[model samples]
Target: MVTTNKEKDLYKKLSIQVSLNGLSFCILNRKDNKICYFKKVDFEKQLDPIKVLSKIELLYEQEEQLNQPVDEVALLFNNALFSLVPENLFDEDNAASYLKFNTRILKTDFIAFDKIGQDTVNVYIPYANITNYFFDRYGEFEYRHSLSVLIESFLSLPKETDTPKVYLHVHKNYYELVIIENGKLVFANSFEYDTKEDFLYYLLFTAEQSKLDPEKFELILLGKINKNSEEYKMAWEYIKNISFMGPFHPFTFEETAKPKEELSEYLLIKSL
Candidate 1:
């Protein structure tokens, strides 16, 4: 097929990040290098995949932007059902086995994997029903575990120091902890928490296990946290050098569609 100038001018991309707790999406106009639309919806409580799909369907029916055709679609599944394996040690045929010991999976669950950089493989379970719905609607689309996108985005950053740096991507009830040293990923994991104390415990524990001193290592915050958030306050009590992840993207945002926090939707925007 030959490409046309008109088609090229209409180039746009949609990237969505979905989890049991909520869903967020953004539409980017590639020609202008701008994000024209962005929205996030949080559920009152955690929902199953079926319920989440229904919410997504309703959003598409109600939101004019979501109904518009786009040149590309990328869906990211964010959940705790993931495990990272070294690239050399990963086996495609036994993907399930790699996650079995860490994540609970049934025989009927669908498994998927995303190779990150040259050294890591992220193995996880995506919502089959959600994937099928997207296929029926968009024909062909790209999908990956949210952690894969997160890790890739972080790795793309320039290495500033040899000392290990800790990154925390906070969600509603859970958060992802990632440590990097000399521009390479050293540790990554997710933890569920109900209170600020639980969050602090996990953060400190992970820092200890990584042999990083809380008072010395730099901690960068991303996602749903802020200076006033309880999670931030608890972390500040121990960690000395803590800062929120800065605006690392160059894309312009539509004034009306801009997110309140620059670091909000770090993964969704980067996935584009």
Candidate 2:
């Protein structure tokens, strides 16, 4: 794990992000809306999550913040193990059977649920170690699909274009696409890709399948994508109006905090 910020001894609510190859933690002081503590550990390659999280728990074991009452922790899961079910037809009794169709259901998997948009509910797994750690410490907390936080926050923005707009939030090996039109959700899905060709193909294909002209539709890129990466170059070759997403309102980092741009929404969306 690489350390990025100086020590801040403030006690605050925790926000944790768990992914296939990494984990992040942020401490938020709600009274002043400040991000007092932040740390992100990116793995060189995929590691066993439970082992990684246990190591992480030890890394921060002495921090006073962990001792504080953290019943209000927010989780942003970064796996493909998530499904969006319509609220009207959502079956609590058959969640495992339903999600099995989209993603595999492991025996140790514990279902984490959250309400995303007005009509949809997200069923996802927060992985075993994450759930067990937070529950053991906080007793009760809230969880959300990492992608749902991005989409829900984006839809709250004022309408900007008459044409369809696609939001792509890229992570280590997956990306989320959300289409909006006239202030309503048009399409929302996640795609995983390994090569730049695969990434661009999914982006363009989704737009085309949605009947959105890649040349005309606007694309907002978020998460770990970089301007120097081939993913951006290939995407720019096909789509127009592609721009990086900005931070959520009312979130501030201390002069020394050095908040990460990639986790902007992940850090502040729960508060929003």
Candidate 3:
């Protein structure tokens, strides 16, 4: 646990998760892996590069201890962000060099998500799917993979011993749906979709191929969909027994220290 001058806190660590989709920053505690502060900065403003960096610095400046040498800095950026930079080519080397600290860019691995449960499908992006063209050269493939792995590892299953399970994952432009029966992967696939209807059609197609009773499998949806969101509504309309990517018992962690109303999406980093 890393304590700070603000008061003795439990953990001390910093991690930055940036996606081509958007930028997500988190100041975490290494002790319990609890996030102390987190915020997502959208690119809607089209700020200058210096301004972007300045915003990052300000974000870190908020923490008293964060001013010192940072132990690690992990970033996930879209590849295109660097394509236009002429001064410094923003490849993996440049991204690492730009961060300029003891940092490691995590590696993304395509692993079957279904290896964990029955009635559960395992999902993942196959390595063949990665393209240097679409994923900016400065992209963080490994970071995304690491985060997904962390979520999967952190979520526990006790009551789900005898049922089948499914694993789903979100990637650059595709979603993977997998089927697991009795702790083994049976069917797996990745498909691209442009609309919600497109996604639902694929889901129905995959479900038909699995040939299992829909009622036998618990539908686990991950990524970004709220209960009342259209995504969730569509999924539930199809499966009816849908559940979010649960992290077992997440409410136990009150480390964000914020009121429930102010909780950020970083909590979704864990599968729960």
The best candidate in terms of TM-score: 1
Q: Which pairs of residues collide in model 1?
A: none
Ranking of predictions according to lDDT: 1, 2, 3
Model 2 per-residue lDDT at 193? 90
Best by lDDT: 1
Query: What would the TM-score be for candidate 2 when compared with the true structure?
Result: 0.86
- Comparing 1 and 2 on lDDT, the stronger one: 1
Give the alpha carbon lDDT tens digit for every residue of 1-272 in model 2. Answer: 11112333333567777776777777777678877767677788887777777767876785665455442567677777888888898888777765888787888778877777688778877777776776666666666777678778878888866877788877777788888888878788888798999999988888888989877888988767768879999888877788877654666777655555634444334532
TM-score preference between candidates 1 and 2, better one: 1
Residue 79's lDDT in candidate 2: 74
lDDT of all predictions, in order shown? 0.88, 0.73, 0.45
* Model 3 lDDT per residue over 156-212, tens place: 444446566665554434465656566545555456666777777787778777875
Candidate 2 achieves a global lDDT of 0.73
Q: RMSD in angstroms, all models?
A: 2.5, 5.2, 11.6
Candidate 2 lDDT for residue 234: 86
List, residue by residue over 1-272, the lDDT tens digit for candidate 1.
11122233467888889999999989999988999999899999999999999999999998998887777888999999999999999999999998889888998899999999999999999999999998887777899998898888888888888878888999887899988888899999999999999999999988888889877899999988998998899888899999988868889999977988868788888988
lDDT of 1: 0.88
